[model samples]
Target: MSIDAIIMGIAFICIHLFANDLLPSGRIQRLKWFSFSGGLAVSYVFVYVLPTLHKEQITVKKYSDYLTMESELYFVGLIGLLIFYGIQKVVRKAQKEGENKKARTLFWMQILFFGLYNALVSYTVISHEVLGIQAVFYGLAVGMHFTAVAHDLWREYEDIYNRVGRYVLAAGILMGWIFGVNVSLPPVTETIIFAFISGAMILNVLKYELPPDEEAHFPTFAIGVISYTSITMSLKFFFQW
Candidate 1:
């Protein structure tokens, strides 16, 4: 295993495990923190993920003659978003109707799927040829992304998340890193995974950012977006990372 990649994986795991402590305690402060993270995550998606996705799409197109739709990868991305939305709907509906039993069952279901989602996204950390400063940038960007996602799960199922869900998601990151260390998936398969992750990540970040008007902090979020985007552009210019 590349030490840098392993450390990146550990960084993801830590964010999932200790996210609440890492976040602010006050309601308004927490909202602003999430808002900033949401902005950073979205900026990374547009600045980095999309360009990388283009390369993944090209690899997909080059490798597969039978599955040659230009938007096949995008369709997978859409599916990822839809899957998360569906889980959210089911959990909310069950809770709204006061079906505690159903909601509890669905809570596990949500955690499982979210863990898989985390794993898939984590796998890309190593699957991509990231190294040195590029790896650090990636960890910071996606670490913030995971923070928003973990907070959502924490809000949805705080008790269970504190007891078991966080550990499961943390384990998912470790598993993804271990798998990436052991098995090298074909470029086409890897690209498809990256596409799905991109879509899911976009949905997760936006979900928090577009919360109730009372909760949204546009100014902090705007700072996050602009600052992160500028830094990303500068890195691309100076280091070509």
Candidate 2:
């Protein structure tokens, strides 16, 4: 990685680590800003990431004769969503079961899943060839998404999250960045990883951010969705990506 990319990667990690603390607890839960951020993230995933994944899927199909299905990328994404959903279900069940064997097992499950998620995100951010204005936009969307993720973690784990979970996430990001800077995965492998992350992003935003229980501000969320989607679509059209 270039020095510029490495600096940007560190900056992104810092934003992910600290952005949640910048908002007050009540605002983090109830603010329209969170809705706007959620909208921005979800829109970016649908508008930019999914299309790129589709293109990658075509390329992967063209190169690899061993593949039997054309929709392998989408299936990989489905697996990602299902895996995370299963983890979430287990954790919720454990939480309801109180301080028992299942709860402890599921608590660690949540921690491990999110740690790996953060590491995957960090690795993708550093290793992807996104640059210039596109990189900035991608970083902004992901940073907002990270803010939502951090808030969810804090709400779910309370003092445990404050004491230890945040540090684990930060370490995950750093470790992922270190690996991304030093090593590179093959093209097909990278494509599969990106597809999986895209699916997880879709699941995370829809499940956590857009739920009816969330105090989402519709006007702000609509504004964010329309604005970011318009910008990204325009860029894609102009650049013919």
Candidate 3:
């Protein structure tokens, strides 16, 4: 892996470990930041990741006579979104049940789900050869998303999340980075992974980060959305990616 990848990994770990403390506790401030992060992530997905997938699909279509599924990546993305949604529902139900045996079981299940999610994200960051400025933008946006996730987890299960959940998620990122360095998937597999992540990111950001209008800072969110979108579009236009 490149030095940039290593740095990005360390940064990701830090985000999960310390993001809660870094941001203000005020609801409005937190919501604003979340909105910004959400915008950044959403823009990256819509502008870069999806376009890249489409380009790869075209390439795959031309070369492989047997593999003719044009929208396979998008399908996998939808699956990713649904899986996370289901996990969230289960976690919410568990929270409502309060302290019980079944609640504990579901709590652990939520941890496991997030661990896998973090691992996938780390693997994508390292294995995809995202370097330089693009990597910086992607990593920053993802770090913010992680911040939102950590906040939500803590809010739901403060004691357990503080004691064990954060560590599990952190370990997931490391494990993913290690695996990504050692093992490379085929092109189609890589594309599918990317698509899945894209779907998950969209759902997570939109669902959790953006709250009701009264709670959200529309100006801040709009700035974030416009700024990141402009940057991405500019990069694509000038670099012709």
Candidate No. with top TM-score: 1
* lDDT of candidate 3 over 53-81, digit per residue (tens): 78877766665677677887777889999
**Model 2: per-residue lDDT, tens digit, 83-197?**
9988888788777868566765676668778778888888887778667777777878887787788788777766667777777777778888888878899888888888888
- Cα lDDT of model 1 by residue, 99-155, tens digit: 999998999999998889888877888888588888887888889888877887898
TM-scores of the candidates are: 0.94, 0.91, 0.92
Position 34, candidate 1: lDDT: 75
lDDT of each: 0.84, 0.79, 0.81
Each candidate: RMSD: 1.5, 2.1, 1.8
Clashes of each: 0, 0, 0
- Runs in model 1 deviating more than 4 A are 209-211
Give the residue spans of candidate 2 off by over 4 A.
24-30, 211-214
| TM-score ranking, high to low | 1, 3, 2
